[model samples]
Target: MTDLHAPAHPGASGTPVPAVPEQPGTAGTPGTPARDAVPAEKTGEPKRNRRRVRIDHLRHVVVEVREHAGYRTVVRHAAYTAGGARLLTRRAWDSRTTARHERMMRAAEAAGNEELVRQWEQRAYAYRFARHRRRVELLQMAINAPKAIGYATATGVGTLLILGFLITLGTGDTSDLLTPIEAVVDFVGWVSFLASVIWEPALYSLPLIALGAAWTVGRRQHTAPAWALPADAEDRDVVPDEGAIIKALSNLGIAPLNKAIKDGWQPRWVSPTTRSGPGWHTQLQLPMGVTVEMVNGKKKVLAHNLLRKPVEVWPTEPPKLPGTLDLWVADQGSLSGPTPPWPLLTEGTVDYFKGVPVAVSQRGEPIMGKLMAANWMVGGIMGSGKSSLVIALLLGAILDPLVDVEAYVMAYNVDYDPLKPRLRALVKGDEDEQIEAAVHALRRLRDEVTERGKLLEELGGDNTKLTRELAQKDPRMRPKVVVFDECHELFMHKEHGKEAAELAVKVMKKARKTGITLVWVTVSPTADSIPRDVTRNTSHRVAFAVGDHVANDGLLGSGKHKAGVTATTLIPGEDVGTAVTVGFTNKPFEVIRSHYVAREAEKGVDEVTPVVKRALKAYKVGDVWEVPETAAADVLTDVAAVLGDEPRMLTQEVLHRLAERNPSAYLEWGPTDLKAALEPYGAEQYKSGGKSMVSRTRIQEAILDRLAEADEDEGDPEI
Candidate 1:
């Protein structure tokens, strides 16, 4: 009784392969004709026999195991083995799990010595269509490039239509001598003939234009500038103009991005949320997309002459969360000089970019990103606005993720108190803690310098730059900065003073080019404050408001005195918080204005401070203070917090009420401590001493109940 029933396999002949046992249950007998067991029609037709199509006990169990682990990976391997077409797709690219499944299936096949080909075929059912879809998407980007040429024809045909309409308006004499209109029309016809002839010569030139365009695109790597809407910018239409283009271009500092925008290319606006706190901004995202290409005749896309670049307009600007800037920039203030008819610096990133417009070129090169670090340091100081000057320097160093750089703070008697809130020790908003942290940070930097020198010696390297160079050639090394703030404060302190001087000397004299740039900020140019050795070899010097000729002499010496800049004029008698910056190649200029970031913006506020405080403490306890590569930005943000303003943590009303009697006492309180003390109470806070306070939600409700007995009178936001 040859009742033949067996599993089908493409690998063997047109016969059912033998089925052997691998799992608990076994199916039809081996050597049976699998098709005969099912039906004759099903074996020849495309559709499989319905009975076989249905998963049996073994097939069903295999699927269940795969789902519990990872189904995608299993599917990927099945497809890889079944490849008559390109099998792996974008989704399947990460199918390591599927690959594992395939391996497992192979092992089972070899161990049992059973038919494996049929199982592989059954597992591939899900992926046949999915792989096709991804391939189509990849082809579209290139397919659309040729369509850009169509834009030129519309302009040309429209111009021709106008000319033809005008020609119809003229009346001409048909017989004998020509009338005036006839003569004019004849002249126009001849001009058209000439234009046609000239166009032939340019046909040759057209190819050259294409070659140039290709060359431009090839040399310029595709990096677009990040766009930011101002805090107050609304849904009002932003007319796409050269100015806006230039401003956009300025951000990249590398490519002419504005040109790309102007030439009608589409732009990609990323989510603007920072890497660390992506969830911070819950606001709706801006909707925008930009694309550009030149479509030739017949609506074919032209590669060289890109006709249209699309840009999608966003509904709203992305909100800048606190401590976000530190992630983008490297060190602050490189080319920080002033220029202009207004109080502007010659070049700092902030000073020059505060109000200037920017955009990408058709080729996407930025016009201004290069200007921030222009002439190195000597050129950026003068034009950089007072508040933005530091921002300018820092923006270049800190914002550039690709470059390896860091900044040191040597601030003394300066207005850079906005940086305290983010310092781990000062997060509680303690004033003394803020000061101690600053001092502690300086000491740490000095120690870092000593360690760096030793490390370099051990490696037979002299500087950080050289160390980085060698490390790149090898491995096992990191690029770091020993930063200093209010370094002039070093002169005031007794124990750390000499150490600060020694550190400054070591940095300026030997480590300047070793990737170390001394950021020496001071109120005076007095020779006594800054060492002559520092001034002599030091290539960059930034001068702010100071007193008398001594200040001027301490900087440019008597050389700048004849230039009409004196200490008295630099700082008016009563007013403070102003200064002048001198750089390498930039002329001395004034930095009069800059946007001061709110304290909360620099320091992590209520939304995340509690979490940060716990994390900072956890790092201390677990001895896991090392910065992760991905988390390095947060540590750098801590650096910016140290550079930013004092946290105005508490509400303004409470501080005002607390200080109503002894105004001086509240005024003198370090902004760091003042903010933390009032956080639970709730209040408006500011860096420049205009502190405020408000009652907490719970406390305010209680106060409302006792309003008749209360001493004060200002109401809450709603109440």
Candidate 2:
């Protein structure tokens, strides 16, 4: 029972054998040994056929020298050197494996065989076209932004003008013949005065200005656009590493970019290939299979490629695709247990502190990488890993020496005694003192902000550029990150409001280049309590499971917040360490879990209680300016209930309108009283509009004041 599927037991070849189908009902079962055998026809080895692809010695030499009679003479080679010197193979051929497959197909005539062949051919074709298309792009760029073209144009115009001026000087001689030399000297002196202050008679500045314009045109406009991103998309594509793509293509029997392009084929843009960041839009047309067809009845190119998930596209003039990305990765190691080494723990992710990764398309590229601007806002409820995240951030700061990041934490909570060991201690200040510290920090920030404004004014550029300049000048002057936990106290305390709010605006406006970022967390916020402009201007936001939609609106935008989201929205999979991250671009990314540093230390217990007591006492200390609490309903109703039901006097609406509308002498109730009575009704609840009545308590007070001020005619009473 010789198996036909098996290829003649290795050495036994050239013997023809029958084909076997591996379908489920047929002979293809794994238990069936014959089903997995290679056919005898595919067993034969193919003889190698070589073609010369080496550099020809005679063709390679442009110049030749011969030593004769103790002297050597060099002379150019005669002709036909270029053709033979280069042995670039133009076309590729099938290997022995292909021949074996062909033989098997010829014997069996299977559909599977045909499909495999077609896929191979298509892959080869796509690769051939990619290189040529890239070259086409390069040529287009050269034509579009050629230095020679600009240089030629500038030279031609400058030469023509200079020649015309010289000719005019030789032919006209307008200076000496027409005007006196004293006039030119006076004009020059006046122009110099103008250059200094107000005089502008100097004619020499014209040529200089022209030269400056040409110089600016020749250089400034030539700089490349800052950003270039993908088109027809609101997001970015994340491609696999280049090594993977190369291996996959090799396994699939497809030629790579060079071969595919030369053969005028489109290779499938498959994954496992290196990905360039956002700005790169693929202009080279690839065979997209039958998916993208032309409306017109014409031939269309198609290829097979794989695409990865897209990321939210950040804005830039000409967007640049990122070489690497920082994904807030989930399923990280648990902080409760022993932690693994960074590389082993975060094998695929960028280092938490370093944030570095390999760039796509470029081999051995230098990556300085993006640094986190020392400022960021972090917030979460008590058990939502807020403390852990802070600890992790601190540890990360300690790890990264390049940025030289420093941290300053300000806790206004009464029970900050727990932070004594970790946080460099600040005084156990009263509520007012805590607020004062917040304000004092802001005041220091004020001077810094003023300095930055002046710098921007003087330098005439944005804060980002200014930051780069400052960083370059001072290495030790590292970025500073300001952290505020339970910062609501700062705003809740009335005294710190004006200074804090003003400081927030100032730092936000000018802090970009200064490497100062603000990170504040509050448990609750109200409309009047939190600054509106600050919330709106903050580009990066993270709102964990908050209490309500209003807080949602504060973190996310107003529309999205109120629409579908609620404060108690629970992500089912996460028990803890769950959050949502958003960047300046406002792309919300969900986080199921996060890794944080273990608590190496804790603040002492007794100290925290005293601090809390001190803070509470200072806050509760009796003050004259303190407002007495009145129930909300009391302010709205109670004493005011009489006004809601009463009639009004001296009412603007009642006098003339009452004459026709009501026609009554006993009109104790005017339109004013009528309107007042309708106070309980809403805008739509009422049939008409009128002034609301004043509360009786307020009315009585007003009456007493007026009576005291009134002048009575007591002497002429009733005479």
Would you estimate the TM-scores of all the predictions? 0.28, 0.33
**True lDDT of residue 248, candidate 1:** 31
Give lDDT per model, in order. 0.35, 0.37
The prediction achieving the highest TM-score against the true structure is: 2
The TM-score obtained by model 2 is 0.33
Best by lDDT: 2
lDDT of 1 by residue, 671-709 (tens): 345545434434323323222323243344433444543
Poorest 10 consecutive residues of model 2 by lDDT? 295-304
Prediction 1 TM-score vs. true: 0.28
lDDT of 2 at 5: 62
Candidate 2's displacement at residue 52, Å, is 85
Predicted candidate 2 versus true structure: per-residue lDDT over 530-615, tens digit per residue:
67666665655555556656766666556434223223353322434444444522223322223433332334323233322322
lDDT of 2 at 503: 81
Worst 10 residues of 1 by lDDT: 294-303
